[model samples]
Target: MKLYSGIDLHSTNSYLAIIDGKGKRIFHEKLPNDITTIVQRLELFAGTLQGVGQHRGCDREKA
Candidate 1:
């Protein structure tokens, strides 16, 4: 049941997607560009998250 997550981030909005080791999607949504909101979504998979990935030009230094 290993889980993974990916985010396609944008300036104003983003897409958050979660999937299992088998590549089956468990959760996906378009959400606002707020850190708290993003964290909340991710919290759903708290202890099970194996890895996470993000795409786009957002600066990782500030994250």
Candidate 2:
């Protein structure tokens, strides 16, 4: 099944959640509060996660 990803960024760290079309949580993690780290973590789940969408400072959470 296809998958969807969402991220929530904050001051200290960012929250990430991945869910499948079937409504199952595939993977979740709180990365190093940086965009690069977020991308790297997602890459590990690239095969299962796609169509990423983020907000709340997530777009600017970069090195």
Candidate 3:
């Protein structure tokens, strides 16, 4: 079963989501901005994950 993940990154926290090939949400959670924790959580799907896509929040100030 192929899996895919998407991450919404923020300054203090991030949202992680994993979905199966059929578009069924398998896991979802909000985690801190820690690489170790994120990697640990995603390790379970390492073998089946097709790719991980990340979207970072843009907090740029208007000039």
Candidate 4:
């Protein structure tokens, strides 16, 4: 099954989500904002993952 991932990145943590081609969520979690942790998690699905995307934005107050 082909998989896709999206990450909502913040200052201290990030929300990771993976979905199948039919748009069913297979995995979702909140993880620390560390590259190693993220990479390791993604590696689990490397065989089937098609791509990964991330979104980072500033807070209204900070912007």
Candidate 5:
């Protein structure tokens, strides 16, 4: 199982997406507009999805 993280830091509200090796979405969530929160979420999700070979970003939006 492979996991990837994508964080869209928008002005109003940021969005996060987690994708698997075969391009399947596991988690798509809306988070606060902050870097710390995003990192924390990513780390937590990363820990949950261990043994993943690689992480990738499909599309990204600058905060």
Candidate 6:
């Protein structure tokens, strides 16, 4: 199974969302703007995570 993630980054916090290929939401959380914290949160999804679709402010891109 393939999983996808979307991250909405902000000044002090960020919104992270994960979903399966069928668009079923798997995880959602608000996290601090720290790499370690974000990494820890993402670790929960680990090996199954395939790609990331990030929307930072007005810029839309894949990361």
Candidate 6 lDDT, 18-52, residue by residue in tens: 99999999999999999899889888888999988
Model 3 agreement with the true structure over 1-63: per-residue lDDT tens digits? 999999999989999999998999999999999999999999989899999999997899999
Best by lDDT: 4
Which has the greatest TM-score? 3
Any idea what lDDT model 4 has? 0.96
Higher-scoring candidate on TM-score, 3 or 6: 3
TM per model?
Answer: 0.86, 0.73, 0.90, 0.89, 0.63, 0.84
Model 6 ranges with Cα > 4 A deviation: 59-63
Q: Per-residue lDDT of 1-63 in model 4, one digit per residue for the tens?
A: 999999999999999999999999999999999999999999999899999999999778755
Q: Write the per-residue lDDT of candidate 2 for residues 7-39, one digit (tens) a residue.
A: 887888888988989878888888878778888
**Better-scoring candidate (TM-score), 5 or 6:** 6
Q: In candidate 4, which residue pairs get closer than 3 Å at backbone N, Cα or C atoms, i.e. clash?
A: none
lDDT of 1 by residue, 2-57 (tens): 89999998988999999999999999999999999999999999999998899987
lDDT, each prediction: 0.93, 0.81, 0.96, 0.96, 0.69, 0.91
Off by over 4 Å in 2: 57-63
Clashing pairs in 5: none
The 10-residue segment with the lowest total lDDT in model 3:
41-50
